[model samples]
Target: MANQEKKRGIGFYLLVGVGALFVISIISRDKNTSPTTSTSAASAARPSSAPEPPKAPQIDARVTARELFEAYEKNEIAADNRFKDKLLEVSGKVDNVGKDLLDTPYVALSTGGKFDILGVQAFFDDASLPKLANLSKGQDVTVACRCDGKFGNVMLKECTLK
Candidate 1:
């Protein structure tokens, strides 16, 4: 019994350490990426830039997941309506992940109870999926996406593991 308890304790600490390292790596990557992107007057800054770019999206992901959902709820008259249609960029956790027939990956984030994600789907292009493909279910993350409506649809354009 004592040996088993000790093993469990060690396992818990090891997991925590690994999680911390992962977080540090993500923060550094985000920082290193931002300067390179903003300084270079690339496509995102251009007026005719596409709706959302993987490296840089139209909306900022720093805002908490709850804030975006609450904002949309406030703006829309009916919560049951197309609440997912808002052009929001927010962050949350990867509640589930799946692979399509084409071998592309899709991830779903929990709205933290602010919104319902019944049949909605969030997309992550090729660039951002790698950092998160191997992640576990409960991993916290921030995603840049355009919500389709409260009907529970969102298009994920970017992701940063927090």
Candidate 2:
């Protein structure tokens, strides 16, 4: 009789624990769903427009190609956190002015001497190609561009002549 009572007590506690866990799961599930439901309802009630482009960050730091490259070479994560997605004004000697695989115009600036492999690769849109066409190798140039962080080189986008 005592063994039977003990077994019942253990089974009851196990069932209670499982029930409590089920109740907690349901409560957590409700909590997660409520925010998403409210957000969807809010979005549905609002009028939509064209998505805006990312604006250039207004920072006073005049970062050069060599400096930006060296920073990334030293510590990529720190350099990315500092320079990524920010507007930068870079001045360096032009290494190449050419089109990419998509025929998108680009300007590459040397990070070191002409023999150096690392460069700042700035991509330009179609409208900016005419301006990019005139740039020659070994020319000193200044450009304002949005830093997109480093790959093999310091990548920049939406560049404009400065």
lDDT for position 36 in model 1: 66
Q: Rate the local accuracy (lDDT) of all candidates.
A: 0.59, 0.87
What candidate 2 gets wrong by more than 4 Å, as runs, is 1-57
| Shift of residue 85 alpha carbon in model 2, Å | 0.5
Assess the local accuracy of residue 93 in candidate 1 as a C-alpha lDDT between 0 and 100: 72
**Can you list the residue pairs that collide in candidate 2?**
none
Best by TM-score: 2
Considering summed lDDT, which 10 consecutive residues are worst modelled in model 1?
153-162
| TM-scores for the candidates | 0.41, 0.62
Residue 148, model 1: Cα distance from true site in angstroms: 4.6
Question: Per-residue lDDT of 65-134 in model 1, one digit per residue for the tens?
Answer: 5655565556645532543444445566767887657766677766666446543346666765676568
Q: Where's the lowest-lDDT run of ten residues in candidate 2? A: 55-64
